[model samples]
Target chain A: MKTLVVDYQAGNLRSVETALRHIGASHEITDDPVRLARAERIIFPGVGDAAHAMRLLAERGIDRVMRERHAAGIPILGICLGCQIVLEATEEGGAACLGLVPGTARRFPSECGKVPHMGWNTVRSREDHWLFRGVPAESSFYFVHSYYPAPESEEDAIAWCDYGIEFAAAVERGSLVATQFHPEKSGEAGLQLLRTFVEAG
Target chain B: MLQKRVIVCLDVRDGKTTKGVRFEGNVDIGDPVEMARACYEQGVDELVFYDITASAEGRGIMIEVVRRVAEQIFIPFCVGGGIATTDDMRAVLLAGAEKVSVNSQAVRNPRIIREGARRFGNQAIVLGMDALADRRMPSGYRVVINGGRVQTDLDALEWAREAERLGAGEIVVNSIDADGTRDGYELEVTRVIATGVGVPVVASGGAGVPGHLVEVFTRGAADAALVASMVHYGEYTVDDIKKVVADAGIPVRRQGARPEAGPV
Candidate 1:
C-alpha cells in the first residue's frame, strides 16, 4: 500500500519515515495537499504546538484535503500532536482543531507525577482492534506529551493508559485511528502496530 | 503505569564511542552507529549520544552518526554536548534525533532552554546537568560544567527547577563524584532533585550492577537511569539490567513479553 506521512513542519517526521521504511511499507513524506489526497493510507504524525501546526496546515490547504479524505473513508493514523489536533480542539493555546473526532485535548495536572509524561508506558487495548494486531498485551509505548485527548464519548476510545489519571491512549472512529503515544518509537510492539496498519487495513 | 526507563548512553568522541573515569581518562571504544543498533536490538528503552568532541568538524561527524543511528534504531534517542544555540538543536533534530540535550552550554546561558523550547517545543528540549555533592550549597549539591572541570555557584536542585520553568521538558542529573566508579547512584542527590522538580528526572553515573537501577527507581525516585560503563564494556546487557529491574517487582517494557496486562 502507498502511505503518505502528512508533514505540518511539526513532530518527528524523520522517525515516522524511518519506521515506515523499516516496516517495508512504500511511503512518501509530503505537505502537498495533492500528494496527501492521492495516498492509499495516511499517517498524520506531529509534535510541537497545535495552534502553530494548524496554521501551517491551513497555509498549505492540507486541512481541507484531510477532511475530504476522511469523508471518503481513507485510513489516517495520528500520533502525539497529530493525535491531539484530531479532536474538536486542544487546551494548548486554546486552538481549534480538526473535528474528525468529538473531543478536546487537555493538559495533565501538576499532581500527575510529571507534566510532560516523558518515558515508556503500557497501553491496554480496549478491544481486538486491528491496530493491536501482533502487539502483545500490556506492551509499553513511548510517550512524551503533557496534554492528552479526552474523547467526548467512551465508545470512541479504543485504549486507555494511566499516568496520573486514566486517559484515552488510542481512539478510533471509522477510518480514523489516533494514539497519543509514539508507535514509531515504541520498538518491536510498535513496529507490529505499524505493520498491522499497513497489512490489515 | 509508566515503566521506569533504561537508557544506554554512548559518549562519542571523534565518531567513536568512548568511556572515562569520573569524566576523565577517556579512551576510544567502538563505532557509535553499530553500538546503537546493538543496544536497540537488545531492547534498550532509550539511547543518549553525548558528543564529547570539542571541534567544529566533530559536530558534523556527530550529526552524521545521528542520521545513521536514526535510520537503524527504532527507539527514542537524544543527542547532547556542545549544543549551544537553537540552530545547533535544529540541525540535530533535522538529522533525525527525537530530542536535543543541552548541558554545559545550558549552564552558561540558561535562556537557550527557553529559546529552543519556544522554537522546537519544550518536549524536544532536555536539560543535561553534571552536579557534585557539596555541603555548602542550599540543596547540598553544586552544579559543575565542562565535563566536571568547572564548578558553578548554582545549586543543582535550583538549576533543575529553573530549567524546568524555562521550558526544559526533562532533566538528566549526572553525579560528578559517582560517575565511572561502577559503584552505585548518588541516591541522596537524585532523590532530592527528583522530588524538587515536576519534570521527569534521569539519574546518571555510578551504575555497576542491576541493583543500582532498582535503587535509583525505588529509593532515588528517578524516572530513568542512564548507564554507560556497565553495559558499554559488555559486563551486562540492556536486557540483563531490565530483567533484574522487572524481577524486583518493578514494571518494565520487555520486548514481546507475556500479555499479562489485559484490558483496563
Candidate 2:
C-alpha cells in the first residue's frame, strides 16, 4: 500500500519517511495537495504551533483535499500536532482546525505534572482497536506533547495514558486513527502499529 | 502511567564510544554500534548517543552510527551534540535518531530550540544542560557548555525555563561536578531545575549505585535518570537498577526477577 506523509513545513517528516521505508511500505513525502489526494493512506504528521500548521495547510490547499479524503474513507493518521489539528479548534492560537474529530485541543492542565509529558509512557487499552492489534496493554510508547485533545465522544478514544491525569493517547473513528505519540519513534511496538495500519487497508 | 526509564548514554568521539571524567580526559571505550546493540538486548528503556567530538569537529559522525543502531534496535534512542540547526537535526532524524539533544548550540542560539521543536515536534527536541553548582553564582548553578569546559554566566534554572518556553519537550540536567564521581546525584541542583521547568527533567551524571537512582527519582524530583560510568564499567546492570527502584516503591519497567529492596 502506498502511504502519503503530508509535509506542511512542520514535523519530523524524515523520521516518519524512514520508518515507512523500514516497514517496506511504498510511500511518498509530499506537500502538494494533488499528490496527497492520490495516496491510499494519508498521514498528517506535524510538529509546531497548531495555528501556524493549520495556516500552512490552508495556504497549500491541502486542508480541503485532506477533508475530502477523510470523507472518502481513506485512512488518516495524525501524530502530536497533527492530532491536534484534527480537532475542531485549538487553544494554542485559537485557530480553527479540520473538525474531523469533534474535540478541542488545549494546553495540558498545569497542575498535571508538567506542560509536556516527555519520555516513555505505558498506554492502557480502552477498547480493542486495529491500531493496537499487536500492542500489549502494558506496552510503553514514547510521548512528547504539551497539549491534548478532549474528544466529545469517549468511545472515539481507543487508548489512554496518564500523566497527572488520564488523557487520550490514541483516538479512532472508522478509517481515521490518531495518536499523540510518535509511532515511528516508539520502537518495535510502534512499528507494529504502522504494520497494523498498513494491513488494515 | 509513565514507566521508570533506564537510559544508557553512549559518548562518542571520532566515531567510537568513549567516556571520561567531568567531560575531560576521554578514553576510547568501544564501537557505538556494538555498545548500542548490547544495551538493546538488555532491554534498556532508551539509548542516548552524544557526539563528544561534534562541537570541536563541527560535524557529526553519530548519524551513520544511529542509522545502523536503529536498524538493529527497535527501541527509542536519542542523539545529542553539535545540533546547531534544524537541518542538522533533520539529518540525524533521517538517519534514524528518534530525538536530537541540543546543549551548547541551544545555549548559543535559543531560536534553534524553537525551530527544532517547531519543525520536528517538541518530542524530537531535547535540551541538555551541563550545570555546575557555583556558590558565587546568583542562581546557585551555572550553565556550562563545550563539554563542560566553558562556563556561561547564565543561570541553570533560568536557561531551563527558557528552554521550556522555547518549546523543549524535556531537559537532561548533567551535573558537571558530580560526573563520574560515583557518589550520588546532585539532588539540590536537579530539584531546583525540575521544579522550575514545566517539562520532564532527566538527571545525568553522578549515578554510582542502585540507591542513587532512587534518590534521583524520589529526592531529586527527576522523572528519569541517565547513567554512564556505572553501567559502562559493569557496576550495575539496567535490570538491577530498575529492580532496586521498583523494590523501593517507585514504578519501573520490570523485565526479570526483582532485586532485594535497597536503602533509599
Candidate 3:
C-alpha cells in the first residue's frame, strides 16, 4: 500500500502532500529511481518548465524508472506539467517526454481567450473508471496550464475541458491516468479524486 | 463550462485581520487563519491573504500568516501586498500558497512581473492595481499605490495590457474611488481593464452585495470578483452571497465544498 509521489523539483509538492494526508493516505515524495520503482503507487506531481523537468528526470534517471513502472502496469498519475511530460513530446521547450502515453503536448491558442487557461474549468468525462469514482460529471477543477495534451486516440481522453478549444483534461488508457488540473487545490471533491486514485488498484 | 469566481480577501496588518475605509483608518477584525477556515466551509472559491502592514512598511510579505492559513484551508489562496522580487514570489508559493500578488512593488519595477512569471509560472503571479478615476488618463483611470495614497503615471488600461504582455496571469483592478464606498465596482475602469487584457481580470475594491458580483462578472467582463468589506462585516455570509450569484445564473463550485462531504 505504498504511494510514491515522484518529485522532479515540482513546486506543488507540499500541496500534494497536504491532500494525501487529508485523505489519510500516507505517501512519500521521492526522486530516487530505486525507491520510485519499488513504490506500489506513483504520482508525477509537477509545476514549472517542462524542458527543465525533463532534463532533471533524465539527469536523475527518474524517466527510465517511470518507463519501467509504466511497462509493469502500475497505477500512475501525472498532475499539470507532470501530466504533459507523460506524453511523447511537448511544444514547450520542444522537449521529448517519457512517451508513457500516446500523445503530444501543444500550446493553447493565444487568441483563444487567454494564453494560460488559468482558473477553474469543468471536466466532462463519460468514461467509467475508478479515477472519477463518485466525482460529478462536469465538476470544475483549478487549472493553470498554457499547454494541454492532444491524445493520439480520442478515446484516450477520459475528460475534455474547453478553454480556447476543448482539450484533454484527463487522459487515461489501461492503468495510466493524468489530469491537467491540480486535485490538491481543487477543494473537497478534488481530494476525493485523489483518495480514489490512492485507494483503487 | 468555466465558472466565474468569488474570492475573499483578508487584509492583514501586523498579523491581525483588519479593514479600512478607502485604505484609511483600519480596525482589527479577527484571526485570519480561523476566519479563512470558516469561509472555506462556506464555499468561497478562493482566498487572498494580503500583507497590508508589511507592504506599507516597506517589508516583505508576511510568510508566516500565509503558512498558517494554508495549513488550515484546503482550497487554493493567493498571498499579496508586499511581494517585491522573484525570490519573494518563490517563498510565498513554496509556503503552500498557489499564487502571489504584486502591487506597489510591481509599479516600482515592472521587470519583477516578467521575472516572477518566468521563474514561477504566469498563473502563480498576480498583478494588483489600485486605480483612481482620472479624466486626464487615456483609460480615464490612473494607477495608484501605497493604499491609494500615491498615483502613478501609468493608465489602468495600458498597464493591464503591458502586464499581460509581461506574463501576468490575472489582474486585480481595484478602484480607489469605489473602494470601501459600498457603492459598487468602478465599472468603467473595470470594463476597460478586463476587456483590454486577454488574461483573467479580478474586479476588486468595492463589493457590497452579491449582485455587485454579477455586475462585475457580466458588464465588467471580469472572470472573478474580489469581496472584502461585505464579508468581513457579516453583511453576507459566503454561502448567502454564492446562492445569490448562483441564483443569478452564474455557476459556482457550490457542491462538495462543505467540511463534511455529502451529495449536493
Candidate 4:
C-alpha cells in the first residue's frame, strides 16, 4: 500500500519520510491534496505551532481533503502536532483544529515538571488494537510537545501516558489512529508500530 | 512516567567525529555518519551533533553529514555548533535533524533564540550552555562561549532563565571544568540549573562511568545525561551505561534483548 505523508509545512517531514524509508514502506511526502485523497494510507506528521499549522493547512485547501479522506474511511495516522491538530481545538494559540476527533488539545500545566515533556516515556495501551500489534504494554515512545490531547470520550483513547497528568497519548476512531508521541522517532517500538500500521490489516 | 534519556554527543570537526579536553587538544575519532549509525544501533536515546568547526564553508559538510545520519537513523537527533540564523536552523532541520541547538551565537544574539523559537516551535530550539564554576557569579557559575575559551559576565542561572523566557525549549548545561575529566558531572551547577528551569535539563560533560548518569538523574535532577568520552572512547557502550542506570531503578527503554520480530 502506498502511504502518503501529509506535509502542511509544520515541521521536519524528513524524519517521518526517513522512518518510512527505514521500515521499507512505500511512501511519498506531499502537500498536494490530490495525492492525499488517493493514497491507500495517510500519515499526517506535524510539529511547530498549532495555529500556524492550521493556517497553512487551510490556505493550501489540504484541510478539506483531509476531512474528505477521513469521511471516506481511509487509514489515517497522526503524529505529534498532527495528532493535536485533529482534535476539536487546542489551547496553543486558541486554534480550532480539524475536529475529526471529539476532544481538545490542552497545554501541560506549568507545574508539570517540564513544558515539552521531551525524551522517552511509556505509552500504555488501553486495549489491543492493530496499531499496538507486537508492541508490548507500557512500551516507551519519544515525545516532544507542550500539549496533550484530551479526548472527550474514554473509548476514543487507545493509549495513555503520564507526565504530571494522565492524558490521551494515542486515540483511535474508525480507521484514524493518532498518537501524541512521535512513533517515527520512538526507535524500535516506534518502528514496529509503523511497520504494523503499514503491513497489518 | 518519563524516563531519563541517555544522549550521545558527537562533536564533529571537518566531517569527522572528534573529542577534546575542555574544548582543546582535539583529535579526530572516525567518520561521523558511521559513528552515528553505530550509536543508533546500540540503542542511544538521542543524538547531538555539534559542528565544532562550523565555519561558513564547513556548514555544507555538516549538513551533508546530518542528512546521511538522518537517513540511517530514525531516532530524534539535534544539530548544534554555529547555527547563527534561522536560515541555518532551517537548513539543519530540512536536512532531517529534529532540533537545532544554539550556543555561542545564542549568547551573542539572544534574539536568535526567540526568532528560532518563533519560527520553529520552542521545542525545536535548545540552549547549549557552556558554564564554569565561578565564585564571582551569583549562581556560582559563569557562562562561557566559543567552546569554553571565552567567559562572560552573565551568570549561568540568570542566563538559563532568560533563555527560557525567550523561548528556549531545553537547556544543555555543559560544565567546562568537568568535561573530559571523566570524574563525574558537575552535579552542583547541573542541579541548580535543573531546578531553576522549567524545561528539561540535560547534564553534559564529565561522564566517566554509568554511575555518573545515575547521579546526574537522581541527585542532579537532570532529565537527560549527555555523554562523550565514556562512550566515544569505547570505554563503555550505550547499552552498558543504560543497564547500570536502569539497574538503579531508573526507567530506561529496555531494548537490549528486543528482537527484530518480537514486541518492543
Best candidate (score: DockQ): 4
Question: Candidate 1: where is the Cα deviation over 4 Å?
Answer: B21-24, B256-264
Which of candidates 2 and 3 is the stronger one according to TM-score? 3
Better of 3 and 4 by DockQ: 4
Q: Which rank order by lDDT, best down to worst?
A: 1, 4, 3, 2
Q: lDDT score, residue B129, model 2?
A: 96
lDDT of 2 by residue, B110-218 (tens): 9999998767777778999999999887779999998789999899999998998898888999999998787999998989988887778899998889899999998
Proportion of the native interface contacts kept in model 4: 0.82
Between candidates 1 and 2, which one is better according to DockQ? Answer: 1
The docking quality of candidate 4, as DockQ, is 0.74
**Candidate 2 Cα misplacement greater than 4 A, ranges:** B21-25, B54-60, B70-76, B84-90, B104-125, B165-167, B233-235, B254-264
Query: In model 3, what are the clashing residue pairs, if there are any?
Result: none
TM-score (all chains, Cα) for each model: 0.95, 0.88, 0.94, 0.95
lDDT of 2 by residue, A133-198 (tens): 877667778787778877889988888888888888888766788998888867667888888887
lDDT of 4: 0.88
Better of 2 and 4 by DockQ: 4
Compute the interface RMSD for candidate 1: 1.9
lDDT per residue as tens, model 3, B1-264: 677888999988887888774456888888888788878877778899888774433333367777777776777799887778787788878888989999989999999999988888788889999999989998899999997999789988999888888988899998989987778888888888888888889999778888898888888888888998787767777878778888989877675366332111
- Backbone clashes for every candidate come to 1, 0, 0, 0
lDDT of 1 by residue, A67-130 (tens): 8888889999999888899899999999999989999999998888778888889899976777
List the DockQ of the predictions in order: 0.69, 0.41, 0.66, 0.74
